[model samples]
Target: MIAATRELPAAGYAPEVDGRLKAEFTTRLRQAGGEELKRRFPMLRIRIYDAQTHAREEI
Candidate 1:
């Protein structure tokens, strides 16, 4: 399961604020979930980059 952290810039020195990695993670989990259906569904990140982009465009 994925756990939320209060720290910034994890071991990879990646940006902790932006949700790029989170989105990528969710994308991958969706694939894994497709394969493993019997067990509990894994926790995945849900970053809304598309919505943010549309919001900016509207503004």
Candidate 2:
């Protein structure tokens, strides 16, 4: 698994906040042909985790 950590402001820990990051990341990935890359490498996945709440979501 690939893991990343970022220190966010209190309000930045909300789902909408994280979701926006996910959306933007996904958009950039897709623009860079992430779909084709994923097809070639099926194990690739993007996930988000909240450190404060210890919550996780796959995007």
Instruction: Give the winner by lDDT.
Output: 2
What does candidate 1 score on TM?
A: 0.16
The 10-residue segment of model 1 with minimum total lDDT is 50-59
Angstrom error at residue 59, model 2: 0.1
Write one digit per residue (lDDT tens) for candidate 1, span 1-59.
98665433222222112333332221223234432532343353322222222221100
Q: Which residue runs of candidate 1 sit more than 4 Å off their true CA positions?
A: 1-18, 21-41, 51-59
**Segments in model 2 whose C-alpha atoms lie over 4 Å from true places:** 1-43
List model 2 lDDT by residue over 1-59, tens digit each.
96664444333222223233332231223424444645676775734445455564454
Please list the Cα RMSD from the true structure of every candidate, rounded to 1 decimal place.
10.5, 8.7
lDDT of 2 at 25: 31
- Which whole-number lDDT from 0 to 100 does residue 2 have in model 1? 83
- lDDT of prediction 1: 0.28
